[model samples]
Target: MSTTLSPLIDLQLKGFKVYEKNLTLQEAERPLLAAQIFSRRDYYKVLLLESKCVLHYAHQRLELDGGQYLFFTNPHIPYSLELRTDRLHAYACLFTEEFVAAARSESLHQSPLFRIGSTPLFKLPASQADYVRGIFHKMLAEQQGDYPFKGDLIRTYVQLLIHEALHLQPADPVVQPNNAATRLTSLFLELLERLFPIELPTQQLTLKTPQDFADRLAVHVNHLNKAVKQVTGKPTSAHIAGRILDEAKALLQHTDWSVASIATCLGFEYPTYFNNFFKKHTGVTPLSLRRKD
Candidate 1:
């Protein structure tokens, strides 16, 4: 994230930045969370970054070999990483949901990038790295010109990267689509889908509580739990907690915010409480996860 101001986003949102003007900056962010970024309070961001070091997020450490690829999450998530070696290579960029805002179309969905449903992070094989690099390299090169559509061009490059990365992933496992065991589980997911700004695996927030989601759905908490479990083979709280953690992972990897800020966002009034809760569930403290990154 860069401290200097830019015209890329509206000023009303409190955001953060970090950037690289030269080579040594890379060494500065050892055990770095994210390279540099700006996040608006109004909307979340989708970031792209490069790294040669291993990263931890979603309870896993991504091997950062040149052929491997991972995602830079928004604040609605949690993520972390630690350098496996002092020498690593990476580049990243941030764009909000509004940044990629476009009308729905086959091209929008069929595009390799936007087609991803839930798991936003993807790993690319050696065969596809060059293809992915070519698109980002072009995006990086575009800054050299005074093109009137530089922003648009960069956005296009990002979209292409998503599509290409998706194209190269292994075939997904068979999970039946919308085949819940009961009507309530379906309703729960429906309500969840409508709840925008969910805890991204890259974020932290209080929306994790069952009551918060229940109030939105206007259903009794126990009823909501039973309904979701009967239909999905998992408790409703499990689903909620899972969503929170997934988003937590995303935020940890993609943003530079401290654990306290992240805890507050995820709904804990106190950061320490949030820390204990997360550690209890994930077996790792938030800062521990961040330090790993």
Candidate 2:
């Protein structure tokens, strides 16, 4: 069954305050939030559960029965839960992308930490659970203090947890090396798709080039370009231009915004630039496209 998790605002109102920086750790409490459909939050989520439950993420589901376990959810994926046990005792820790920025790691989408489109649940043995619980306790204890380095310490603890997870089930280096190229390409396309539909007349895409995405993914431009071409049979820049042109056509046809306004929204420095770009890509100018529409 689909369930809607609480929003960040609702969670904050219910005592999930930011303990330090962009991180917040919330203990399960009374009058539990209702289970609905999928819930999307703009931060990373880690839940250490003490009860059995079924979690639905994207097209897949995981059934956990008793024992301590760790489940991870990144900002990109929306998930829901169905509590199999009446008593739901869990500790949820949330942190934004910027909070853990200092740690140089793979993009969550391509990282083995959570895997894509699925909620990763790692069953903790009794001994391991005790150790993991201690980490959570330390975070909780640190919450009571005003130490300036509190955020840094918590980020380190989170990193510890990630390392532990990796240790438990390390990715196969041999297989991954072969698959990494395709995976990176796919992840890039997914990231590109996220900034779409131009919901408003003012929404501008910050990632306008292959280099921007390469920087974000922590990969060199050549590697990213090669992977994209190998997988999609097109150059990296072509995909970007195609998407921008698609967005431009959609905007011109649907919105009454002027050409200049549309140009700015599509990341063009000037209307003349957008006009030339549109013409180069579509054999017609933005105004011409709008007239046809």
Candidate 3:
């Protein structure tokens, strides 16, 4: 039987004060609020907002200014932002594995761009940021406008996001070669890319164990932990559990799945155990989050 995994990037914040705020920014000086998601999955979805906000990432943060960019990948690799401006205009678009296939020939699957073992997320510097911004803005305009070939154009812009990101670097730090520890962490990250959607936290159906994950990858548990920690600076269990809770929140907010059923799907042997686990992770009962319509 197929297990149900959690959904990545659950953005429907329940009952937050921000929900009642304005969503458009026509003002000339409105700041930008953006967050780029870097994930373990194959999809990349960037959120471009017109207000100011913090950029959410796996381990770090970016303070967004006017008309900023936020990139995302699947399995919700840690990214989000809290907008500061009064009005927020944002467009979120998703590109799947199709992007890679469309970008390169079959033989180049192993190329550096598509390599599962390297960094998958990159942010544009201020110098080149405007170019990328224009591409994405054109995309948003195309999406909002009624153009005959709007769909095709949107895909083209999405392609540009990836292409441009690969070339853009941070302001103060330049990317360097991967060291032994970095290599190990990169391998674990690659493993997450492969394992995430297949063992989706939302699906609730999965082995749900670090040992099981290590076994599936044919690596020792300690070795895997070392590698994952070295690269990401977070423990393997932290990623796994966080991914699970993310989907749990998504489903709890979006679906009518019974808590017991959701729990079982997430690999808890008993509903009570799942309940406790949920409480421990979220500090609130599952029903509280699910109570909203």
Q: Pick the candidate with the highest TM-score.
A: 3
lDDT of candidate 3 over 171-285, digit per residue (tens): 4233453686665555555555443342333564444767867887677989878877867778888877776776566556545678887776677788899889899987888
What are the lDDT scores of the predictions, listed in order?
0.55, 0.67, 0.55
- Candidate 1 residue-wise lDDT, 9-43, digit = tens: 43332222222222244554643433433433233
TM-score of each: 0.53, 0.50, 0.63
For residue 146, what is the lDDT in candidate 2? 49
Report how far residue 177 has shifted in candidate 3, in Å.
8.2
| TM-score: model 2 vs. ground truth | 0.50
Off by over 4 Å in 1: 1-37, 40-66, 70-75, 82-88, 97-117, 169-178, 182-235, 238-293
CA shift of 16, model 2, Å: 10
Number of colliding residue pairs in each model: 62, 4, 25
* Candidates ranked, most accurate by lDDT first: 2, 3, 1
The candidate 3 region of ten consecutive residues with least summed lDDT is: 12-21
